[model samples]
Target: MIIVIDGLNRHRFGAVLDEMYRLRARVFGDRLGWDVDIRDGKEIDQFDHLDPAYVVGLDDEGHVVAAVRALQTTGPHMLADVFNAILDGEPPIRSATMWESTRFCVDTKRLGRGRDRHSVSYATCELMIGSLEFARRSGIRDIVTVIDPVMDRVLKRSDNAPYGYVGKTAPMGKVPALAALLDCTQERIGRVRDFAGIAHDVFLTEDAALDLFARGHTSVEIETAAHAASANNDTRPLSALERYFVEQMSAARTSDEVQAVIDLIDALPGTLTPEQKFALKQAPAALAREA
Candidate 1:
């Protein structure tokens, strides 16, 4: 399924975005050898800081499989600011109803090449459908994307060919790039849906998405636990028993897991600080409510 992450809901989907960025690093930095900024195993750029919306795809396992970034054309965007070279001598297209779509990618390692639900084709089409539908709902009229010739061909094959081109293609990084325009219309979306044979809703609820990641003790939970466990620089280190309890809580996905930690803590009293004891006591109830 898909999830739209923006500045409004970014905090709740930290783990998902982290995986998406890592996938981008793998695709754009390592595999494609693109001149992109990759730091701490994440491919991020100034556009990411501008509160752009991200249409991200997730597999059955809740892992991030595909993603694309959407930025409003009226403000600073990739094509206007960073990729102006692709625009040649023409002025950048800026409109209140248009958006710039970029960073479109899929996880080829986890997804296969067929048209199955677990294949790259399905994910790609799903992403296209989800993004187009989302843009249409958000009052966006068109999308201008900076993509390579391979992506251009893929768009054509998927029945999502751009309606027009902005400027001449220019050399960018290791390959040539051009700006292509696509209108956010139901006919365009229907063509992609028919090609992919998808009839269900592609978007996932925020809680549902979080639940899927919780099964694996996602990195977001780990990071949250780390922050709580080390809030004081002058505090003494956590005991082995304390550390064990914290680890268990951090990895707890179900009420049963949280209850087990609580039972263990009760059996061995005074093993944790008062604050830690309170937090552990609250874990079971929180997990129960989530369930």
Candidate 2:
């Protein structure tokens, strides 16, 4: 299923974004040999800092199988900055009705590229359907993509070929890359759906998407998230224990009490998310003691 995440509200979907970034790191940095920034197993860049939208494809188990990022052309974007060499002196195509889509990738390491409905091809097409549908609703007329030749074939094979090219293909890392434009009309969306045999809605409601992730969330964690969201005035949501930890730490009169609270949070079951791990790492005394 496709779960759409607003860049500004990403903290609410931390696990989904975390999986997407890891998938991007693996696909672009390790597999494709792309020149990119990968830190702590996440492939992220300056564009992620901007309030761009993300169309994420999640498997039944809530893992990110595919993803595509969209940024407005009027603002700082990759085609105008990073992939300028592809333009070859032609002016950057910036339009209010057009957005730029980049980082289009699938979990090739997990889903082998087979023609079956359960393969990477389905995941790729699912991501495409989600992207175009999102663009259409947001009043975007088209999207320009910085993609390699492999993606070009994927688009064509899915019966959703780009209308035109912006510039000549140039070597981007290990693959030849260029800019191509795809319309965000229903016609394009329908073509992709017909090709992929997906007639149901691609976009999942926020509550529905969160429920899917909640399957992986422990009851303690979910209860924590709910209470945290209620008490915190800040836009960011905190887990239940995180809020309780803050409350206890605020009342503690001694450093040892704070260390004890840290140790308690670090003892939760299932698995520690990267955020939780980082939080535990910040408590030097607790970390050293645990080590």
Best by the TM-score measure: 1
Screening candidate 2 with a backbone cut-off below 3 angstroms (N, C-alpha, C), the clashing residue pairs are 224-240
- In candidate 2, stretches whose alpha carbon ends up further than 4 angstroms from where it belongs are 113-117, 217-291
Candidate 2 C-alpha lDDT tens digits along 135-177: 9999999999999998999899999999999978989888889
How many collisions between residues are there in candidate 2? 1
Model 1 TM-score relative to the real fold: 0.80
Query: For model 1, what is the alpha-carbon lDDT of residue 249?
Result: 70
Model 2 TM: 0.75
The candidate 1 region of ten consecutive residues with least summed lDDT is: 282-291
**Per-prediction TM-score:** 0.80, 0.75
What value of lDDT does candidate 2 attain over all alpha carbons? 0.79
